[model samples]
Target: MRNSVLLLAMGMLLATGQPGLADDAELIKNTKADHEENGRWYTSDDIPTYKIAEDGTVDWPTFSGFRRYNAECFQCHGPDGAGGSYAPALATSVMNIDYYKFYETVVNGKQEVNAAQNLVMPALGENKNVMCYLDDIYSYLRARGTGDLGRGRPAKKEKKSEAFTENENACMGE
Candidate 1:
């Protein structure tokens, strides 16, 4: 009976374009009372929402930046972001496209340069953070490997050491 009354009152409120002062008060009271009992009216301050920029770039760094290079470019570019046998290494590529040109292609997706290669890149967008990340990736690639960003660890090499001994002919009695 109480539920029916509440529903009827809400329905009447909806039907009436202009709710009176008492109606509004009743609505608020009912909502608060119900919410207090059900705990369904709580508000959350944080929500994850992706906002794409006008240029199609993501507002935040996509894949935190590195992942973008890895997922979209690493296949042909190699782990270092340097072009492999299948593609031109980023560091030494003749394209020499600076951040702006590179950004254009990234935001616009594939371009018609070297159509014979049949490569079709997709746009990433003009999101400042994302673009900044791209710059970081570029910096990483510029440092050495085609992969943008600084090399995390130096390449390893085998070490050799020797000592002279009285019993050994190679060392003699040094």
Candidate 2:
């Protein structure tokens, strides 16, 4: 009876278009199903989610992350997110920053000047290459930051899902 009432309330909330409730419910369900870790949600089928193998190979998203990071981010952030002489170490920094902050920083960029140095991060929101694979990059960096994924190319990876392909096509406008 309580479950029925809760379901009805959720239905009504959905019908009313109240923001976040449906997503929250889905997040709750996914969390209950063990699709979340350390506050990061993992949608294995639709979005890029990673898994580590016994021999230390990561899933496709993490692999994609490695590629994307090296291509788009390495010059500024340094190899393996270790930070260049100019930029901060993302491998360590990402672990402390919230997802929204990271997103905002990447998309809008940041500039800070202290007594010692001035730092600038150029906005990449308009760059389709980065935007399209932002999640994957984040996943890889987060994994690295948490020490869950090691530096370098993974030897093996899980296959990409049809949903990922579909989403990628839509995002890329293909």
| CA RMSD of all predictions | 23.2, 7.6
Off by over 4 Å in 2: 1-33, 36-49, 113-116
**Tens-place lDDT digits, model 2, residues 1-174:** 999999999898779866555654453222111264432337543333456767876766678788999999999899998899989998777656655677889999999979977988999999988998888887788777767777777677767666767777888889
- Top-scoring candidate (lDDT): 2
Q: Lowest summed lDDT over 10 consecutive residues: which window, candidate 1?
A: 31-40
Clash number by candidate, in order: 18, 0
